[model samples]
Target: MIKRFGVSMEPELLDKFDSFIKKYGYKNRSEAIREIIRERLIDETVKEGGGESFGTIVIVYDHEVGDINDRLVDLQHEYTGLIIFTTHIHVDRRNCIENIVVKGKNSEISALAQRLRTIEGVSSVKLLLTNYTYK
Candidate 1:
């Protein structure tokens, strides 16, 4: 069953939320709010630790940098049990983007992300972690 509830907030906050909704092209405030709540809950769950999760670590780097590409592949192989999918894209002649999809406990996934960030050529790394346990 679906239930509706009232939410009260300052006028300034409401105005900001309306602008955010418009920027995101949400059909209604409820939809935007629902997504925000779900994201927060997932964040909490992931932070609490000791749970299985599936996530992707996306990294952008310059392929010319000191044997970094080989190092990245070696690191992924080290955690083959956690790694499920990998996609590599060439952004330019010298630059590339890689998305490594992994599944494992929160700590293991976080460790993999940390290791990737330490690679010499990695310009940026972002870990998008979420649990398959969530429905």
Candidate 2:
């Protein structure tokens, strides 16, 4: 069920809201507002349980560091279902870039990220995500 309501606000507030929504590429104020509410609700839900989410994990590391490549391979194989695919680039003789596509329960993804982040030669890790249902 849907209900409509009228809202009254200062002109300055309305102008700012319009500008903000425009920057976010929203077609209309109502849809933008609905998305804002949904994002908050999803975050709250994810906090309480392992909500289904999908994200990419990108990492840059030195492949030569203490058999880091094999260690990473072992860890990735351990989480079979979480990783959809992984791409590797030999950035240099020693440096490598790896991007992993992942989808799983929130906790499982987070744990995989944590494990990767803890490895010694991992110079960088970036986790970009949207709750699977959102995008």
Candidate 3:
């Protein structure tokens, strides 16, 4: 079942939304609005920290930095149940990037990201959570 509702906004906002629709190639306002709502709901659900969520933790680090590689491997080993798989990329001779796919409670994922950020050589750590259902 689908329910339709009305949204009232200022002309300026509507103009900007129209432009966004065109920029994103949305077929119409309804499609864009639906996506926006869905994203917001998913974000809220993930933020609540109770439900299981899927996300990727991406980290960039200098491998040569004191014991970083060993520490990184050790930390990841501790979260074997949460981690689905990890893809490591050698960005250069000294730097590496790892994209870790994980599925667990929001708190667990967040905790893992926090731990990754504290690693000595880690220059960047990013966690992006998304809804697990794919249609």
Candidate 4:
């Protein structure tokens, strides 16, 4: 069952929300609001670190810097249980991008991302956790 309720906000905030809905191509304010609420709930669940979560860690790095390739390989090996697979792309002669798909406890996944960030030559590391869990 769906329940409808009234939400009151300042005019300025409502205007901004309307603009956001239009920019995102949402059919209406209700649809956009539903998605926003779902995203927030998922984030909270993942942050609680009580259950398994799935996510991808994307990293960009300069291959020429230090022994980064070897370090990255070793780190991934250490978390073999958490990592599902990884895809590597050669962005340039000296740079590479890696997308690592992982599934495990939220804490474990977070730990892996943190370890990856500490490796030398890593220019960017983005960890995107989702609510999906594999059985």
lDDT of 3: 0.91
Using TM-score as the yardstick, the better of models 1 and 4 is 4
What does candidate 4's lDDT look like per residue over 3-53, in tens digits? Answer: 898999999999999999999899998888888888887777667766777
Residue lDDT tens for model 3, 56-122: 9999999999999899999999999999999999999999999999998888998899999988889
* Model 3 worst lDDT window (10 residues): 126-135
Off by over 4 Å in 1: 1-6, 22-28
lDDT tens digits, residues 1-135, model 2? Answer: 767777799999999999999898999888887888888877675566557888789999998789898899999999999999999999999999999999988778778888999998999998766785764
TM-score of each: 0.83, 0.73, 0.87, 0.88
Tens digits of per-residue lDDT for model 1, 1-135? 668999999999999999999999999999898989878877786677668888999999999999987898899899989999999999999999999989899888888888888899998999998776765
Considering lDDT, where higher is better, how would the candidates rank from best to worst? 3, 1, 4, 2
Which run of 10 residues does model 1 get worst, by summed lDDT? 41-50
Q: Using TM-score as the measure, name the better of candidate 3 and candidate 4.
A: 4
Highest TM-score model number: 4
Residue 127 alpha-carbon offset, candidate 3, angstroms = 1.5
Q: Report how far residue 48 has shifted in candidate 2, in Å.
A: 3.3
Candidate 4: stretches off by over 4 Å: 133-135
Residue 45 local lDDT, model 4: 69
Of 2 and 3, the candidate ranking higher by TM-score: 3
Identify the candidate with maximal lDDT.
3
